[model samples]
Target: MASEELEYAGFWIRVWASVIDTLLLGIVVYPLLTAIYGDAYWEGANFVHGPLDFLISWVLPAVAVVAFWMARQATPGKMAIAARIVDANTGNNPSTGQLLIRYLGYFVSCIPLGLGIFWVAFDSRKQGWHDKMAGTVVVRKKSGTTRPVEFNA
Candidate 1:
């Protein structure tokens, strides 16, 4: 967070990170849902098949993601990509409130055909709508070799 050669993570890398997270979540959630609802679970027209479905499919992922953000500054996927979220102005870890806002902002970003998420490709700071809403940014150091993303004390 000094004058070092830092770079905002690009769009494609972020997209890949999200894909990884979604796949991981599916790996766990899908099994639980299938076990509870049986094979016919996939045939439902309901957005949420039942209370357990809502708990497993919706609440679980949300809690997991928020917990990861709180504990690690980045989710597993972002950590895999060597990127972390920080306060846009201070380059420090964002507050819990900011993290929550960022999580909720995902819906807004996706609502308009994902134009807000796509905004990262054009934004000078490579911020998606969620980052903008929460005053955060995703960044990585210009490392010559692969390294884990970590905060400097």
Candidate 2:
């Protein structure tokens, strides 16, 4: 039998990818905050403080939105794992609006106890709820090319 054109990422792979992405984003964001605020920034607060605190509170989410929305993929983790986000039907990269919708849908997916993520385990197409809502799919990229799967159905 022919192999499936698209396969869902296994749970462990997805988990690892999340971890890697979080660490990478933190590596970039934290140092930038530190440099902008300096040692005196966190002088008295129990948590983050001063310009650094504001930056962390506000800028981080905005940056995350812009990065994913503009790129149609997460910054590092998905890229490292050869995974990318695209439109489910056309298998094309998402538009900026689609990316924003997808990112926002992540919040909904996280609600009701993250059942959306678990949908991959049972979905025939292995799509999460967020993927469905946003009309997006995550697929593995070929090593030397950008082509994604093409389905006749």
Candidate 3:
């Protein structure tokens, strides 16, 4: 396990990253949803209004996000801010299982009035509940410092 103090990405940066990702997903998802549901797209706030809605809203994003995390160790949003996700203890790329758990953990983070996500703002390591659940962390490179791919935790 890595054994050193590292700079963890805090809540605001992560929130902004999430916004960017959400917007990007929206660009593709909204049009597809509109086409599938037509005028009834916004008829009600139901989550699973139809099969396509379930596929488009939930399945697709989960797949895309996990794929990005596996392939790049970060999503486009995380990359934009020079942040990457890694095992919390190892400071290396998280396992596929961990990535999946992290994705599901998002729901947990959001369900309870977003307290889990907000935890990042106060945690010493800047970890949210999803990060804690998946044993992962978001970190960025220190200015003028070049370290190995695996951070020193």
Using lDDT as the measure, the top candidate is 1
lDDT values, one for every candidate: 0.86, 0.67, 0.84
Error of 1 at 98 (Å): 0.2
List clashing residue pairs in candidate 3. Answer: none
lDDT of 2: 0.67
lDDT of 2 by residue, 1-153 (tens): 111444445445566778887787778776777688776654656565656666775678667745864665655677667667767776666778777777777778889899988886676655778778888777763333333355433
- How does each model score on TM-score? 0.90, 0.69, 0.87
For candidate 1, which ten residues in a row score worst on lDDT? 144-153
lDDT of 1 by residue, 12-130 (tens): 89999999999999999989999999989998888999999999988898899888988888899998998888888777889999999999999999999999999999987788999
lDDT at 146, model 2: 32
Which ranges of candidate 2 are over 4 A from the true structure? 1-6, 31-54, 141-153
Model 3 lDDT per residue over 1-153, tens place: 233334677788888998999999999999999988886877878879988899999899989999999999889999899888989877878999999999889889989999999999998788899999999989876542323233444
lDDT score, candidate 1, position 138? 89
lDDT at 98, model 1: 96
Q: Of models 1 and 3, which has the larger TM-score?
A: 1
